[model samples]
Target: MPLILPDQLIDQEVLNQENIFTMSQDQADHQDIRPIKILIVNLMPKKEETELQLLRMLSNSALQMNIDLVRMDSYQATHASQDRLKKFYKTYDQIKDQNFDAMIITGAPVERMDYQDIIYWKELKHIFDFAREHVFSTLFICWSAQAALYHYFGVPKQEVEEKIFGIYQYEKKKEDPILKGFDDSFYAPQSRYTYVKEEDLREIPQIQVLSSREDTGVGLATTLDHRFVFSFGHWEYDKETLHEEYLRDLDKGLATQIPKNYYRQDDPQGDIIMNWRSSGSLFFSNWLNYCVYQETPYQLEKIKGVKVAKFGGSSLASASQFSKVKKIIQAKEDREIIVVSAPGKRSKDDQKVTDLLEKYYEGKKRARDLEVMIESFRKDQAAKRQEAQEALAAVRTRFQEIVRDLDLEEALKEDLDETFQDLDKTQSKDFVLSRGEYLNAKILARALDYDFIDAKDIIRLKSQDQLDYGESYKAIIKTIHKGQRVVVPGFYGANAQGDIRTFKRGGSDYTGSIIASALQSKVYENWTDVSGIMTQDPNLSKDAKRIPSMNYQELTDLIDQGAQVYQRDAIDLVKEKNITLKILNTNAPEEGGTEIKDQEDK
Candidate 1:
């Protein structure tokens, strides 16, 4: 292997495991990048396991990342052996002179203990002072969070009668660097019995609460200066780590509570997978990208200063508003994109858009047009069948374990029927899957907190209002470019006479790309769940290295020549403009998303 590993390693294994590292040979060759340097202080019970978990989260970043383990000898948090620490851990004395781009302190089993009583309290205090003055940004997890919080603010830890175990829902506290691109509600794993109380932490004038669980206390917090981030919740933990702990405790005669808000049926015997890992990787990667990679000085700073530094400015404050517009614009700007049916249900238990649209079409009482729509609808129904098949595949093993002795054919038919019935009620695609794009935009516009003008406001742009198609587009573009983002629905037209006429499907992507090209943005950032462009199909490659940057022709070739990554019409919209479309993991924007541009073949 070269300095960087081959971007695609055992491609089949990647797809099989659903790992998001897939990359093409061209991407690998062009992106001759170096690994980011990170320091991890293991304060947990299982040092190496935590090491692998943290490294796994780091692995998803496009950059090469090297991990340095930091060990403290004074505490009873004996996760590592003396030999192992000597062999792999770098002592503070040896590394105090060096600076790191990023640092993570793992959770220790000392939260219930007093600060002065702990054997390593004095040394850990020194680490705290050093973190503020020396390190670029420090991420303190679990016990480290409590220790740092109390040490810096004198906010004390309170013991809990119950261990807060399992997956907990965390509401985003505020728009900050560490919480970028996170949804309103995301999951984090909490497995601690004690935490710093909010009232105590609130006493500190400089504390910034990033997130908090109503019952679990503060989920995450940061110094007002923003240099130190403390996550009371274990967002960096592996999905099943808590489960393992729970099971171990149960086996050891230690009282264990079933992880609350976990295991759908609330059955302790029910099977569960690590859904929280996705959120974990997404959150930490954002921290590394925004706080460490983007903000930290590339040059290392020695521990020469210990003065307190204050960090807040209009620049940081102003970014939150732009981020909303920027991320949506980015999600809009991708080509060769295969849009799934219907936008996701807005809420976990909301009706889909497709069903309501279908019902409305039926209510109009047009036999022939309704027939045509139904045929189109029936095809979507077929697609949903395939989707259900895949969904079933996901829990094939679990299905066997949970629903064993089931009738094979009858169950399959029943599953397919349920999937189709649900599809009928749910709106799958907005522009690509259904006609709900217009409706969705109206809702989304209201949901947003900025300037919005309906397309109807521009009468000339209406289908029957006597405006040219290009003219209406230009007018809408004018509004959007003037910093007023609006949605222009697909499949509609306004004549020179300003008469409205409707068109076919899939024009929204083209409109978005054209608008992006005209605006001369650096790159179109498309937000979606997966990481950027891959070498083989996501189904084809598993450990597909997420491509960093790439050429345009290659992108087209990938889409055109068997890749099916995007639609050509959208690519053609900006081909002349040479606009680059970057596909980002909406879940992990700081993973340095993949960019698509015209390539220079070697």
Candidate 2:
């Protein structure tokens, strides 16, 4: 069977020219069987070139596949226009909720910087989390493999004194499905500035080394489950990829080395060897058949669910807390609807984020305030900062005379003022107070690579304090599609006039309830500090025990008696919808917590 792709893929003509069989989406839709859905997170700079290389490898499989191309929303590609990206590619936000049979994340030209220093590092991490729960199998290539190692296993990549640029030989270390048809050794292209220590990966119990070379360390590795596949060398690279890189590096005045074992008789002007194409095709085929097509559910929606999870302030207090929350979400593929609250204190002495925002808002605002905020946001490593500053300085100096009359500072101020010109005193206060949740949701959304759906955009209210459920349901349905994971700030919604209005201090639980009700979710999870509803407050009684299960009436009675585990309104909403409500602990999810239902199970 031929590969199935979008109707207007820009590289379809190129693939056709190479004798690759491909069918359009419209043509595939008429078929009775479901095509394997594959998502390609293309991170390479030359979008069209990388598309052709990857598509050629994917076409080797007998199973038909529908390809969805995704691009980084944070990084703008100078090589491709915005129109091309809009038409041909999707952002992580657009498909995070959707499940995939397999995913391919390509390498980028950012091996020099520290992983955290990359502009889209947080966003990429989100995609990594998504792959864990949403994708059946994911192939990470080159720099992306190094990134996956660091993100998933805490294995770091060390900067090599010289770039490993060549077509190198790799020996198979294991008899695995991925290397089922491979020989004792195979050749692939390697162009990288950093390498991961083989010893570090071997120490992790979950990871297995499939192939390696003495000079290149670990060329291929996978998790014990085989859900994640990593390749240090580029098997999908064309015969001329390295040649183009070499020439481009030379043009930039960098000391570049000729690719080894690539050109005929080692001559720069000679014909390319092109020895890796067969192996690349076989590898992709094995992955599709063994890792994805066989293991993924025939009905993709069978793996999906409308589960809502609400995380409180303490659960999102620090960066480490955010990482914990991401792992919790990854634990279950069905945990799709995520609700988040404002940041809490890092320590007993630290002020609450809401108070800090209120204080900042009540005080006089200055340009220096904006600088401080921007400085805090741009907390990249010193080396990266210096490099960026130097580059900016050079650009400014070059453009000094050409734009001598320009007032850069005034121009920046004007842009900032124009963005916030509509905020009045009341609206400004609401906006500032809401920033704690808005900013927290934004950070979490970037970290999870999921869509950040603002509550004001979907959570409609009839008046300042009353929710308009009818209108809100329609808005939520329109904003969120089937199979997408999204993050929404809690405790606030928009009134008829579109002014931001917040609920009581602990109203985030209510926000969670509304979303669960709107989506008609089967289970609404409230993640907090406590494991579940307790017979007694743990703070007051060291002997308090977690309630295993309770009926809706019992929960309401406890709420009437002043149990602060859930808001009364929130409980009522879920109760009316007959949705099971689970109270779980973010700190220790293994404890299992408590469950509330309309009636106790016999």
Q: Which candidate is the best by lDDT?
A: 2
TM-score per candidate: 0.46, 0.55
Query: Which lDDT tens digits does candidate 2 get at residues 257-292?
Result: 888888999898989899998888888889889989
**Each candidate: what lDDT?**
0.55, 0.79
Error of 1 at 545 (Å): 66
- Badly placed stretches (over 4 Å) of model 2 are 302-602
- Model 1 agreement with the true structure over 1-602: per-residue lDDT tens digits: 11122233224464336453434445544765544557788877787677656666776775655456778866534555776667777777767766776788888776777778887777777677567546778998888888887765557777888888888887886888777878887888888878776766654434678778667888888864456888887766665677788889899998888888777687767777556777787787788788777766555553222110000111011123224333543443221111112233333454433444444334322332334565667655555455544443332322232123222334344543454454345432221133333333332333333333433323233343233434544454345432233444332334455433433333344434544443433345454445777755665668677778777777777777766455466676455444557666544656776777665211
lDDT of 2: 0.79
- lDDT of candidate 1? 0.55
